[model samples]
Target: MKNKSLYLYSFNQRKGIFLLLLVMIFTQAIYFFWSSNTTPQKDKENHQWLALQSHVDSLKQVKEEFKPTIYPFNPNFISDVKGYRLGMSVEELDRLFAFRKQNKYVNSAKEFQSVTGVSDSLLAVISPYFKFPDWVNQPQKEYVKFENKISDVKPKTKIDINLATQEDLIKVYGIGPALSERILKQREVLGGFASMEQLAFVWGLNPDVIENVNKSFAVVSTSGIKKIKINDLSIKELSKFPYFNYTIAKEIVTYRSMKGDIQNIEDLTKINGFPVEKLKFIALYLEF
Candidate 1:
């Protein structure tokens, strides 16, 4: 009985306590060993990541040792890698890409800057190497220079595009009854043409046809225009605009409702999908 109890604990009870302690210590030692091995792997990964980050940082800090030879390039066709090589950042490249996707050409360095918003210093460095199509650079300059003598001049009065009849429009090279009708329809919808440039947007009129129309007719007068008041315009009412589609009308209404009245070209330009390029011409046809 004395052996069974040593300070209120029996022999079996002491053995059970000793075994429990040994098990606890054994599990602790095993866990320590496992963690020590796994910790080194985690540390190795962390060290590798830091080393790679350091390498990237060093690369960023270093400047180009030599400038690459820049051949004459059409600024219109600049690719991502080409833009990067030309010192254009991603944002500038993206803007230019968006412009080109609309089938518009950048005719001059000034236009390029307007579209891309590139830095002037960078533009100066790159503009010298820009080569454009002959038509853009000159309209047969050599031919015109060779023959200095002027041809027989016939003074033809330019007709106003807004008031031109179907017969008058048909006199242009490519405008037939169908095209003339379409132009008149467009004029009726928009109240009047703001400029001769609006002829380019007429359906079925190509560049050559537009040029012909411009030579024959012009937007001589802008008076009596049926301009839409856009500040309180409903989506349907705004959608009736020649340029604004249903989607754009909805967005405009949404923008107006949320942000307040669209006061001017600057406010319209801030809209998510408004075409900022044609804002000047667009502003002419809209009533404040």
Candidate 2:
């Protein structure tokens, strides 16, 4: 009787274990089937997301391709007939020629509305690209037609730097009474700039204004100053000497660094852009 009872218990335990195993296997099969099948709705969402991403990428590429080109159109002006050079970069020639009167030209892209002939649609197109150079000012100044007052007769020998008064300085374009006083003050302070760059150091001289006027002034320094430092001179300052511009001055400074200190006047020949003739003129006043 005891052995039969033990055998019955063992048989029941085996049946219970087998039933649990069968249930686990059935649950795992259902999970695997569901995971393997993708729903149409989910597939559609993925496809749409990929298409949207591709379209965005294409638009980005198009913007990048045209980023370098300049386009000018005042967005306000719909009438295209009156607008000339509607889609062009501002050239120096354009700046000079576009002026009908002094200070009348549309400078800022936003200022296109002020132009007399610009239509609303044309201004709308040009507003984005039509920025004014720093020199252009608004509330237009009257165009003083250049009077060739001193054409044939040379003026009473160039104004003497040592003795020139405030009135003397205002005769030159771009130099005002205040700036003229400042120039004299700087000369007194630094014992003269030892170079033209000193004018740039004046309290209120605008760099662009200096550049424009520098070409007209000739250096008559009889004081025998020599060897102006190229690296220390400002563009307007360096430009006062004959045949020197910002570009040439920059090249000289660069060459001085690359080749080490300029050894002698002849050493300038090794630098690009410094022609022999130019070097001869420059050698008179330049030092290492």
Candidate 3:
């Protein structure tokens, strides 16, 4: 009876082990089937998302290509929206409106920039599209003298740009009344131009206009310029100059306080944010 009972126990143990192994194999097959089906579905969905993103990017590129184009218009007639579209700041637009309110017209590109205070780079971009009145485009009539006898012709006297009034400046080919006034205003602010090269610093003077100005005028005498003493002036005072902004003025004052008196242009170059390329021009307004 004991041997029969032991034999039955061994057979039951083997049967249980076989059943567990079969169950494990079935579970692993189901897992493999699920993984294989879901992986392809996930990959397809991922591909669709990538394709959608690419389509969106292509649409954006097309939209960029279809951006609105700009056309020529009179700057004098520019409204707030028009000026905004042209990349003008609020202050610049306000200045234009203010000038226009006085029943004045911006006749030339240079005059437009003078009134608006736009940068040269921006002026270059937009000036090509500026339109003027018919009268401005008309040629002036020149009278020729009929001389009976040959005589020595006196050379035309070159006008001094530093001392030239607005009227004198207007006599130049490209300079109008507004541009003349702007030039005079710039000269007044600088006290005087140290050299003819300093004309390049004038806000709205184009290269061609500058050339005309140089031909007609010379920087024969400098106005009595009040030079700022670098060591003595406060940051506020220094910042008042055209070349020095508040940040650069503060930095200069701090550097001076820390290192003592700035000896020369070389010393100023050591200060952070100093306008190194413009030092020669700026030095005309400053004293060491």
Instruction: Put down candidate 3 lDDT per residue, 93-169, tens digits, no spaces.
Output: 99999998886788899999999999999999889988885536658648698874657776678988877888888
Best by lDDT: 1
How well does each candidate superpose onto the true structure, as a TM-score?
A: 0.47, 0.28, 0.51
Off by over 4 Å in 3: 1-72, 75-130, 133-155
lDDT of 1 by residue, 230-282 (tens): 99689998998878889888999899889988888788887878867667778
lDDT of 1 at 162: 82
Candidate with top TM-score is 3
Off by over 4 Å in 2: 1-155, 161-167, 177-217, 224-263, 271-282
Give the distance in Å from residue 267's predicted Cα in candidate 1 to where it truly belongs.
Answer: 1.0
lDDT of 1: 0.85
Query: Backbone collision count in every prediction?
Result: 0, 22, 0
Better of 1 and 2 by TM-score: 1
10 residues in a row with least lDDT, candidate 3 = 133-142
Q: lDDT of candidate 2 vs native?
A: 0.59
Q: How many backbone clashes does candidate 2 have?
A: 22
